[model samples]
Structures are given as C-alpha cells and as structure tokens.
Target: MEIKDWITLVVPIIATFLTALIGFGVTLNKIKREFKYTIKSYLYQDIKKLYRDLYVCLEKVILDPMLAFEDRYIDELLNFKPDIYLFSSKNLIYCYRDFGTYLFNINEAFKHYKIEIDYEDYDYDDNGNVVGVNFGEDEVQEYQFKVSTYKEENCPSSKELKEKVENILDNLKKELNMV
Candidate 1:
C-alpha cells in the first residue's frame, strides 16, 4: 500500500477512537454528579425524618404537664441520640448524630438538650469481648442550641415554644375538665 494511503486510513481511525473516548468521558462525569446528588439528598431525607420525629417528641416534653418526656431529662439524655450516615467508594460506613436545646424557662430560660444517634460499629482493636457497637460516639452538629436558652438564640423560637406549652396545657385541661 502507498505510504500516503496508509497515513490517511490511520488518521481517520485515530480520530474515531478519540471521539468515542471523549463521549465516554462526558457520560461518566454526568453519572458521577448525579450519583453524588442522589446520595446527598437521600442522607438529607433520612436525617430530616429523624429530626422531625425527634422534634415531635421534644415538643411533648416542653409542653405536656402530664408529659411522657421532660425537657431536663432530655437534656441529660442528649448525650447520645439521633445520628446520620455516610456511604462512599472508599468508606463503606454510615454516621448519624445531632444536639439541641433541652431546657426552656424564661431567662436564657431554656436548657438545651443534645441528641446523637450513632450507626453502631465494630471495635476490633478493643481487648474486651464487646463485638458490635450500638450508636457509639456522637459527632455533634449545632451544639450551641442545647447550650443556649433564649428563644431566638436557641431554637423552637419563643412563639413556637409558647404554642407548644399552651397546646399541652389546653389538652390537659380539657382531659380533666378543669375549665
């Protein structure tokens, strides 16, 4: 074959391969972005649900006189409850934890309660027979809320807090026919 003909054939082949490669690269990048967004949104949803339930429970504590839960006790219990998780190619693990105000009086009035939920893990290095972990250590996020008492400074703003308290009282009064 003539050298010129060979060179022409090779150029088209190289061009075709490079084009294919470029297309593949773009596709891969798009896939990666979508994957990350999916994971972030999923994690957010799980955490949101967990927090919503937690808030419902916390509200009961703040408002209910015949309360199933106590703000102070919750504060004390905040040591560990509610957590999040993580999943990645390098790390196959899940984590979950959170903290918030537990007390609410009037002056710096509210004592915050921090809650953390840990996705238990196994401690292989530990000498003890303890195998798996149950929501081990909590990584605190927004811990200041639990430490502060002011409505605006903390959470469950003054209006929200007052509403909860009144709701609880109203329910109690109605139950007992107090008014």
Candidate 2:
C-alpha cells in the first residue's frame, strides 16, 4: 500500500483503541467507587448498631450492676467480638478491647457480689379478705450495692466504658471520611 493509505488505516485503528481503553478505565473506576461505598454503608450501619447496643448495656449495668450477667448481654458480647476483630480498624479494635475488658470485669464482679431477694405477692379477695399468697416464680429482685469494696476494686468506672465507645465510633467516622 502507499504511505498515505497506510497512515490513514493506522490512525483510525489507534484512535479507536485509545477510546476503548479510556472508556474501560472510567468504568473500572466507577465500579471500584461503588464497591467501596457499599462496603462503607454496611460497616457504618453494623458498627453503629453495635455501639448503640453496647452503650445501652453499659447504662443498664451502671444503674444495676447485676444486669451485666444477663444472657442477652453475654450473647451480644460473644457475637460481636468476632465481628469487631474482623471489620474494625486497628484503633477501633483496641478501643473495643478496652471497652469489652471493662464490661467483663464488671460481669465478674457481679458474679461475686450481686444480691438477690425472693419475695411473695398477695392475691386479695373482695371485702378485704386474704385469698392467696403467690411465691417467687418471677418475683426475685436483683441488685448490687452502691458502695461495694469488690466493685470498687475489680471493675472500671462506667465513665471509662462510655469514653472507649466514643473513641471507637470516632475512629470509624474518620475511617469512612464522615468526620
């Protein structure tokens, strides 16, 4: 072929190749951004829920230390520990560890110092007649002393748990660029 003819054929081929390459790159970048957004949304939701639950648990325990030994609290800790390790940043993981350790100590302290009281309820008939007395089925009251040497010695303050949870959430926000 003549030089002009060859040049004409090569130029179009090169232009088409460059166009396709640029288009592919743009599409790939968009996919990457979308994937990152989806992951971030999931992480944000899950971690927020986890932190909220943890905060509520801490508040309850601060009010009544015996609540630390509830089955729901135990299950939440067991289930979320692995998730925290897997999905949290290094700083977040460390904060969670501090928080979890404090709660564990509180649980242990309650195991030793919690007080339970069994009480009875009376079912009265009309005309002020005594009918029946029902014994403890779900009539048990549980509490912990406000001034306990064991709790003062063993468990960290509830204020500490609040701070740790705040730290973890702050780290998560920084990671996701929501700060």
Candidate 3:
C-alpha cells in the first residue's frame, strides 16, 4: 500500500483505541464513586441507629436512678460496646471509651445497692417429671439481696454522664455530616 493509504488506516485505528480507553476510564471512575457513596450511606444509617439507642438508654438512666439497675438498660450498653468499637471513627471511639469508663464507675459505686428478687415455681409433665421451672405468680420470694447503702458522695451524678454523652453524640453527628 502507498504511504498515504497506510497513514489513513493507522490513524483511524489509533483514534478508535484511544476512544475505547477513555470510555472505559470514565465508566470505572463512576463506579468507584457510586461504591463510595453506598458505603457511606450504609455506615451513616447504622451509626445513627446505634447512637440513638445508646443515647436513649443513657437518658433513661439519668432521668431515673432506679432504672440504672434494670437488666435491659445494662444490656443495651453491653450490646453497644462491641459495635462502637468496631465501626466508630477515631473521635467516636474515644468518646465511647470515656463514656464506658464513666458507666463502669457508676456501676461500681452502686454495687452495694444491688437487689435481687427470686420467684419459686414448679413445672411438671403428665408423669410428674420436672421438665422445666417457671418463675410466675404461683410462688414469690423477696430478699434484700446485696442491699447496702452507699454514701451520697461516693456515687457520681448521672447528670454529668448524660451531659458527656450528649456532647459526644453532638460531635458524632457533626463528624458524620448528619447535622
């Protein structure tokens, strides 16, 4: 083939190759951005839910000291501990650590005042076998289980802890751009 003919063929081939490469690059970039956005959205949703639950539990404890002894409130804190450790950002992690420490101190201070109530029950099968035990209204027993009064000065006020939690949550909201 003549030089001019060869040039014509080679230039079109190069142009087509360049067009395909640019198209592929643009598509990859778009996918990357979409993936990032999806991950951020998921993390934001999870963090928001967990934060709200923890805050509510803390608020209950602050509003009513007796509620602090409830098993459910303690369970909420325990459940949140691992998730916060795993998924929280650096600042949130620090806040979680501080709040956890404060909660531990409060619990320790209240240890003497802990109370336990026991209920007696019997569950029998047709053959009179004790298959299970039910703690119901049939029999009830109450005891001053581990009851001891602590000096008021020994325990930290729940209000202070609540304030710290609120501050942390506010900072978290800002960090997550939810505010």
Give the Cα lDDT of each candidate.
0.45, 0.66, 0.69
Better of 1 and 3 by TM-score: 3
lDDT of 3 by residue, 50-69 (tens): 87887786677677665444
Candidate 1: regions farther than 4 A off? 1-3, 65-179
Candidate whose TM-score is highest: 3
As a whole number from 0 to 100, the lDDT of residue 106 in candidate 1 is 31
* TM-score against native, each model: 0.42, 0.56, 0.69
lDDT of 1: 0.45
Is 2 or 3 the stronger prediction by lDDT?
Answer: 3
The TM-score-based order of candidates, best leading, equals: 3, 2, 1
Of the candidates shown, which would achieve the greatest lDDT relative to the real structure? 3
> What is candidate 1's CA lDDT for residue 62?
54
RMSD of each: 20.0, 9.1, 8.1
lDDT of 2: 0.66
**Tens digit per residue, CA lDDT, model 2, 90-129:** 8877876876776676676566554322112556678867
lDDT: worst 10-residue window of model 2: 138-147
Number of clashes in model 3?
A: 0
Ranking by lDDT: 3, 2, 1
TM-score of 3: 0.69
